[model samples]
Target: MAEELRIRSNGDLASALEDYLAEWSGRSGIAVEIWALPGQAVSRRVAQAVYATVVEALANVERHSHARLVSVAVTTGKAGLRMTVSDDGAGFAVDEAAPNAARGLTAMRAHFAGVGGTLTVNSVPGGGTTVTGVVRAG
Candidate 1:
């Protein structure tokens, strides 16, 4: 990721994410459906946070979800930056999973919080998992 950022001068978040996702999906064998990506440039701090969060979210999906497909979306609006990583996999009980038990979730939340954003995770047994992050506009 660092290499990618450096190559793009650390401003093209969309391109960095695209390359990352393409490589990740190829290796994980999980089909990725990109729903949206910001057309405009985002702040470097916000971009890094979002990128790290997305990486962690996908890592969780690969490690635990057993998902065949994952959908990712990122957009910027009056609410600031919003991102969602949803997977059609074996979802676990959110309440049962302690914060300590799932360090990845904690890390993801921290990524967003570092940028004054909030993270939400929703999942149910046999259903699926959705990780959402929102950073409010200043």
Candidate 2:
């Protein structure tokens, strides 16, 4: 399953996410939008990390956030290729010390770190959430 989910390019990643959102759109009130910037090719390994990060973040939004809309973007810039997933929903405080903090987010952080990348999440009660994962090409 993991092998099948490997992303080959930004466009491919966007299509995969669109399919995922299509499957989940009916289950919740949220609508998903994806934007992929035209640029360089992404390595399979880095794409995989970005893919997983988006998948996990979307699942969280579907299950917990009663958000009306979610936006997913993949862009290549001077820093690197970055993926951002944002949702307008009731957010929760990000507590790294909390027991629940070590689950998905921790795993995502580790995944990005392995590829010389970083993951950042911003959320506050009633302020919505945005998760950004970045990876540089070697």
Candidate 3:
């Protein structure tokens, strides 16, 4: 199972995410969907970073967002390899940084930066949250 789950490249990320979400969605009843651009390729480092970002984002929704639905989309084009995780949950202000900041968001940001990528988060109170990470993978 461990070997099967290992992600050696970007090609493995979509299914890995789907598998990861399947476990929680099955038990928690939150609808999670993953869509990836077919044939898009990314470096191992970028793949790992993006995968980590997705994990953190989904975990956040599960733990705090109280979201009923979550969607993760992956694509590659002129803008590069990008992944967006959106959740229809009880959103919070993205500007009002918590005094005791949650490390999840910070870690997700760092993961993208470490791979020469950018992470953008957009959210408003009572609205949903969208987290997007893009890396130059071409």
Candidate 4:
């Protein structure tokens, strides 16, 4: 059962995650937005990061945002990989961006930094929140 769920194909990662997230988000009433470029030659860690970060971001949206809409965008280029999760939620404060601000986000940042990447947290009083991370794998 679990073996069947394990991903052996590369391009299927995004769709798998999308399908899984679709059900989960539907249950939780989250409007999920996703964008993927074609011809993406995915590797294991790349897919893993995508899953991890999306899960983490959605969890945050569910717990903190109270956002009616959530947008997730992923783009890969010769420079590096970029993932942005934005939500129109009630934002909070993170005075000093450290490894301990928000437990989940702290972990997310660590995940990015672990692979020579960086995560930036941006929020507005009423506008929205956007979490952007870049992982250098290429």
Pull out the clashing pairs in model 3: none
> Candidate 4: RMSD over Cα atoms?
3.1
For 57-120, candidate 2 gives per-residue lDDT tens digits of 8888988878889988888766788888899999888876663565777877877898999888
lDDT by residue (tens digit), candidate 1, 15-129: 8889889999999999999999877778888888888888889999999999999999998887688899999999987874455456788888888898898999999889999
lDDT (Cα) of model 1: 0.86
**Which model, 3 or 4, shows the larger lDDT?**
3
Candidate 2 segments whose C-alpha is farther than 4 A from its true place: 1-11, 27-29, 96-100
- For model 4, the stretches where C-alpha displacement exceeds 4 angstroms are 1-11, 37-39, 97-100
For model 3, where is the 10-residue window of minimal lDDT?
Answer: 1-10
Please tell me which model should have the higher TM-score, number 3 or number 4: 3
Task: Residues 19-111, candidate 3: write the lDDT tens digits.
Answer: 677886897789987665424656767767877787788888888888989987888777778889999998887774552257998888899
TM-score of each: 0.90, 0.81, 0.84, 0.82
lDDT of 4: 0.72
Clash count for candidate 3 is 0
